[model samples]
Target: MALDIIAALVYGIITIIGGIIGYINASSNISLVSASICGLLLIFAAFARLQGQTWGLTLAAIVTAVLLVVFAFRLAKTRKFMPAGLMTILGMLTLAVMIHQFMALRR
Candidate 1:
């Protein structure tokens, strides 16, 4: 699979798992629902990207960016290096990879 696909998949899986964890640990339905939606969007984007669709990368970038910002805020508010911090870091890396892949796609 392409690096873009891999990155998206990894990020999606991680997000989904985090949601599941949140649901299990704290019964946060919002977290589970939001993460599931975001993760599924990423997964769908991966398939679209596999078919050479620009919108796929665009969607992936947007979703990742949103998640990154949310996590960053959560991290800042909590000042704890745990779920929020970890997610923020992952989101940053995933978004970076998606951006690089998008540039390559343009070229």
Candidate 2:
């Protein structure tokens, strides 16, 4: 749980940083728009997680899973454990949330 929280914070910070850099260096409107949206989403998600809401956790887990799947494959050649571990945990959390949500819906 602590690792997940730290990872979420790091991811949010990096997203905001990248968005600012893109806004400053990007020449096209589309690029700026996309970066801004991404940055805002990251910030919002971070705050939501901090609030300890289930929805926030779900969103964070989903994002983490996608990131892990995309980057883990490239990093797998280096035999790194961080990405793989994060992915596995995130996937489990997401699955748990989905199941809970489904059960609630059925009720």
Candidate 3:
């Protein structure tokens, strides 16, 4: 749970930073708008997890886990060791945390 919260917070912060950068550098409004939305959603998801919304967190974790697995596998097959390893570790950690939370909620 702590790990999930921390990861979400980190992700939110990164997204918000990216959004600010996009707004400053991009002439088109669409990129900035999309970044802002992404930032907001990341923050909202973080807060939801903090509040013990197991269902939402589980869904998000599952999707992210699948994406991470696919990314890792592709990278590994291409011999991109660093990124592949990092993604695999991150995906497994997130999946484990979310699954634990989900099981606890079910009980």
User: Could you say which candidate leads in lDDT?
Assistant: 1
lDDT of 2 by residue, 1-107 (tens): 33444555566565455446646676556545644554455456657756766566567656655654654673666566544455445445544554465365458
**TM-score of each model, in listed order:** 0.95, 0.47, 0.58
Candidates by lDDT, descending order: 1, 3, 2
The Cα RMSD of model 3 versus the native structure comes to 5.0
How big is the positional error of residue 63 in model 3, measured in Å on the Cα after superposition? 3.2
Error of 2 at 101 (Å): 17
Total clashes for model 2: 0
**After superposition, candidate 2 runs with Cα above 4 Å error:** 64-107
lDDT of 1 by residue, 1-107 (tens): 78888888889989999999999999999999999999999999988988978798889889999999999999999998879999999898898898888788779
Candidate 3 versus the native: TM-score? 0.58
Whole-model lDDT values for every prediction: 0.90, 0.54, 0.61
lDDT of 1 at 97: 90
Error of 3 at 47 (Å): 1.4
C-alpha-based local distance difference test score of model 2:
0.54
Q: List the residue pairs that clash in candidate 1.
A: none
Per-residue accuracy of model 3 over 41-99 as CA lDDT, tens digit each: 65676688788776557555655565466657767697765445654665566667767
